[model samples]
Target: MDRLSTRFKGTKTYLTNAALEASVNCALVLEKPLLVRGEPGTGKTLLAEAIAEALDMELITWHIKSTSRAQDGLYVYDTVQRLYDSRFGEGNVHDIRNYIRLGPLGGAFTADKRKVLLIDEIDKADIEFPNDLLHELDRMQFKIIETNEEIKAKYRPVVIITSNAEKELGDAFLRRCVFHFIDFPDRELMERIVKVHHPDIDERLVNQAIETFYQIRAMQRMRKPPSTSELVDWIAVLKSAGVTNTQLDQNLPFLGTLLKKEQDLVTYADQLAGGRRWRS
Candidate 1:
């Protein structure tokens, strides 16, 4: 049982949380999909890529959309294209595989070697999509209806499924997966993350920026608190603009970098202006 902590240390992205490390390792050992629920910018999707890089495995990613279907991850039959080809004599109309495009799940299953599969933002898909994936995920095989062929896994893929928790997942679907929730990193962890991207940044500037970052996050009225990535971006912008500690108070123009929502910006501006309380 290789601990993810040891394996993932050399990866580009750093996740120091002990519980998250354990969950990843457990999922790998059990050969079950890891269901990762987290805030939007908590690196849930990046975990899969980092694992693949660390383990030297190929990464297959399926980014789910609201319109995405479970079968879209497995395969998509181009019936209309086949019909058009048949009329125009463009491609092989008789061969079913010609029209069948192998999707992320299908590619992972049929690969000669084990790979890492990232099903990102699974909650974006329809409610039934997760349930629809249960059988194939359990068996590591999927049947291609048009070709009447079964594609089985040559090696069990390392599956990492991420969700933002926009909707509740079905109990039956959740039962089959090893789950982990990634909370926002603490101040120390956040500093390390920021430093990873900005090694040469001034300590004073970093401290001041981080202090302000958390202050904004701690505010009760913020509709969308800045995430780790935004903090990194804000720091990068500050560094590029040669922002100094003394300049921090006078020039908070980069609030746009940290705050995404217009409402958040307006409220924070009010706070800066010494307004009694947040408006909306």
Candidate 2:
């Protein structure tokens, strides 16, 4: 193994390519966030977990959604809770610090040891969301508005952001990141990944199943192709059903495990009737 591979050999459950390893190394050395883009199920979110495991650091994840705001990653003032407390005279309501709550980013910043922060599906938020984070991410510090307290990182955490390309990110945000797009794994890489999950799987079954899996994915009409996770699940189903290598292509046993969409199933069945129409 080369230096990069040796350094980030990936966890037993997660495997990475040279380009991805190099990109991660670049981001670490440059002290910049690594922006990862790929199709859903390409293991984009899992990459952060693997990094944290490999480096023996804590992992903090901020899952972004349509309603997510950039400031939510840093802090949130619990004004409602404070109001309820003040009405009930439950505690000291005069101190605004009592209502201040640190978010994932803030927790990472205040941690004594280095951590890994995964900002998953950043593109799900508004287009300006990424831009709004530029200042704090760049400076590795932020001011808590409620408490007027300055929170700075004791150790800069490894930041990894994932995007499913739901929306276009800003140019400025893109510039600040060490970007890498994770291509879907090819057959060879997929085999290795499968073996990681199913070490005791039969060799012939593995070969036949992989060939069939690729055949299903090759269907241009498929709305959502089966991903790596689905393939692993399908393999487990096959093993449980006592399926043999020769039985795989005969009727595509346990088709539901591989093809999730109804339309895709209909398409495959039609194609099968037309003498394996997916072959091209």
Candidate 3:
């Protein structure tokens, strides 16, 4: 099977993992929704963006929220607005399409060309939402009750769904999708990612930064380990500050970039003060 080994145009980051590459390709070939689950900051969302770029497809994203309903992704009917407009003798009030606004899923299904639909943070929505979405995902079609119209896909869009594992998805919903889990990047992978983002950064500085980053991530007490994106941010800051060495002892000043939680910060600080030497 073909792999998603090419660089994404928007991010210029290549997905190096063979499993991830194969899963993405499988989704494309089978035209099934790709369900990606991973820890926060592990590039789950970025994977969707990369797939869209790789295939040269337009990306339509539905960012799921706690209050998001499955219907919100298909279409929304504005009955109240239509009523008000009818009273005002509005020109388009009689047209059902005027009151019917297509949501991200609906838009994707109706697109003239194949596109990428990113359903981000699917776990944020209520349990029922995924089950509700299953039919449309399988059939690539939905009905608008407002107009009694059936909207079908002109070209099936590539669907990428991301979950941070905040809640367990129903087995029924899981069965419909091609699933994959993205693990945190290893040292070599992390280095490649850093270089992609910061091509001009010094190699010595990159090595030192990775070393220090791993040390902090290895801390058992850290409530939230710094993610690859955070590491990139930290390295960008270090590059700007001209930090030549990994100066583990004096690295406290840059701790804010790596560790976001206050408690995590305190724990790391304590570790540094306790004469925890940075190993090269």
Candidate 4:
């Protein structure tokens, strides 16, 4: 954890040994599911993305939705491909069954090699979805019930599941996973993250933005203040356009590039008018 650095040169993520050890254990040793719980925009999903990117592995992400069903985990057979095959070929039952395609999970398991499985925002998914995935997690295999044929994984990729802690998961489901909570980084760590993401951005701007975000954060009204990634977005966009604090007045329209909500933008504009140097 102490030695873990950002996988990408421009990445702001720096995980401690605790986080790294947990991930490595889940991926290589424990061979168990990892459940990451955190507040919104705390880089829970980014953890999985960074590991997959760092390892040069395939990233198979399932963005869990409220209606996501358990069966949707496997490969989605291209109906068009199946139909074409049926028309052109002898359409034997077994051949037709073989023609059906694999879903994301199925592909992850039975593909030519291993890949990272990011079940993102699992809290949005139905309870049955997690329960259904238990078997696959335990067995490292999935059966396409449509074909009544089993497909096993060549290698079980890192199974990283992220949740916003919106609801409580079943104890049985919790029993299958190694759980951890991701907290917001402190000011010093936040500055390190800023420099890591936007090397060319002036250090002053990074420092100012961090302080302003802290101001916004101090307000209890906002849903969530700017996070490290959002800070990256603001700095990256500003630098890419060659815009700086000196020219913010001329670039008012580009304010959209940084602040997201209209209220935040309004507040920033007011801050600028009060001679507070919002951009700087």
Candidate 5:
């Protein structure tokens, strides 16, 4: 945390501050999990990565998806596959137990030393999933059935959970952690973002892209507007392809980088064909 440059209120810097300072404070005094919420592409998951890097902690990230189950994170049981194999090979229950593959949660809980655990995108996961994590998260440990013993960490792992607000999580789950919400950065800070991600882009092009980005976002076309990532990618694509606003050809194929929707492409093409500025 002390190692991170706090001069900028940019998204990455804000996340770094929140993740490291919050986790260190929580671990020392509060002893709570950290829950981070933001829009997609706002760098919620990256917080743990930056924290682990700054503190020299090993990072273990488990991306939560629609089909993710509570037990899926706890342990990966391969007994079914083993049982099928034993029908052809030597038949034994011991071999099946031996083959049970440990999943991320089991591995993390059982592994020695502290680690940064990232439960990325809890909002996308099943409704009951977050609630089921309470016991394991609170205890900072879990029990593996095969071993018939509890796995406790000498140094409790820093747990960073990210949610995109796609859906609300249970109150029981949200109550378990210290929370942080990351809103999008302002223009000046966003320009710094463009600079951070596309350092080699021309200043004029960067500024133009940023201005156009805000304009397009304001339009709020049928599809969701482009994000900070798209703006950076747009600039990078422009520079790499040697495109200026004037060259025209270089910007056509890469409009997908700038505009993320079908209607947006049509709208942009219409604006370009009409020689319009696309001002809001």
Candidate 6:
């Protein structure tokens, strides 16, 4: 545990826990991708950046979208470019490799040194997307049919994949990964995280703000609950305004920083008007 801690501790802005540490180390040892699922504001995407910083490896990110195809991650043969080159009598139109471009995964595989590959928001793509890359991920090799060239990983990259659970991933795809769920942190953990971000914050203000924050989260009618990042920003605003614990007790200033949605803000206002208090 201590050995793994030394290798992949979180960065100055990032905070990690025991479960995340174990899962990351397990993935590193087994050479499997770490599949992380959490809410949007959680540090799911940041985990890859932290790992790359800790391990001193280059970070390669593939931002998946609704129209993203798994094949695009491996290689793209630009037929349009080739046809244009041929028509215009440009150099090396006969060489198909000239138009071949390596994508993030392909670049990671061909790199001389190992890299940290982050496939962000896999669930944003089509349902078949995860299954499409199964063979290449499993074998760590891909073939470019146009150039009759096969590329293999010089060193297997440390892969980290994140999902917001917007869509269900395939069972076969799940079987190949080391899965970990990052639950929202509890009060103690939240305090530690807040301290990491804002070390000089007054203790009393931190306590009162966290208490109020949790109280807001506990509200049943909230459409979108404030997240960790929101709380951090809220505290920063309070500190800058020289808000005291007593002032926080009376009312939350800069409420926009914490509650983003109109419906949520309206709900909070209604609750406050109904004599709902900030503290239990």
Tens-digit lDDT track for model 4 on 1-280?
Answer: 3123323231335444456555555544566778888766667887788767766778999889998876778755556776776688745534546666666777789767668889988888876678888888888887766667888888776788898877678888889888877767778877877776666668776776667566655544343466667666766776677654633442443445445787676665565565444445
lDDT of each: 0.85, 0.87, 0.85, 0.69, 0.70, 0.88
Off by over 4 Å in 4: 1-17, 20-27, 75-94, 237-280
Model 4 score (lDDT): 0.69
State in Å the error of residue 272, model 1.
3.8
- Residue lDDT tens for model 2, 1-280: 1222325558888899899988988888778999999877888998999999988889999999999999989999999999999999998899998888899999999999888999999999998999999998999999997677999998888899999988999898899999999998999999999899899999889988888888888867788898887888989998988888534353778888878889788777766666456554
- Each prediction's Cα RMSD? 2.4, 3.5, 4.0, 6.1, 5.2, 3.6
Taking the tens digit of each residue's C-alpha lDDT, what string does model 5 give over 56-85?
A: 679998899899988787777677777776
Error of 6 at 90 (Å): 1.0
Poorly placed runs, candidate 5 (over 4 Å): 1-29, 85-92, 95-97, 220-223, 246-253, 265-280
Error of 5 at 204 (Å): 1.7
lDDT of 2 at 102: 91
- Cα lDDT for residue 49, candidate 6: 95
RMSD of 5: 5.2
**TM-scores for every candidate against the unseen true structure:** 0.91, 0.91, 0.91, 0.73, 0.78, 0.91
Q: Candidate 3 residues 1-280, lDDT tens each? A: 2323432233367655778877887787788899998778888888888888777889999999999999999999988999998999876887888889899999988888889999999999998889999899999998888788999998888899999888889899899899999888899989999999999989998998899899889876789999998999999988898878776764554788888999887778777777344342
Query: What 10-residue stretch in candidate 4 is worst by lDDT?
Result: 2-11
**Model 6, runs deviating above 4 Å:** 1-7, 245-251, 273-280
Superpose all Cα atoms of candidate 6 onto the true structure and report the RMSD in Å to 1 decimal. 3.6
Which residue pairs clash in candidate 2?
none
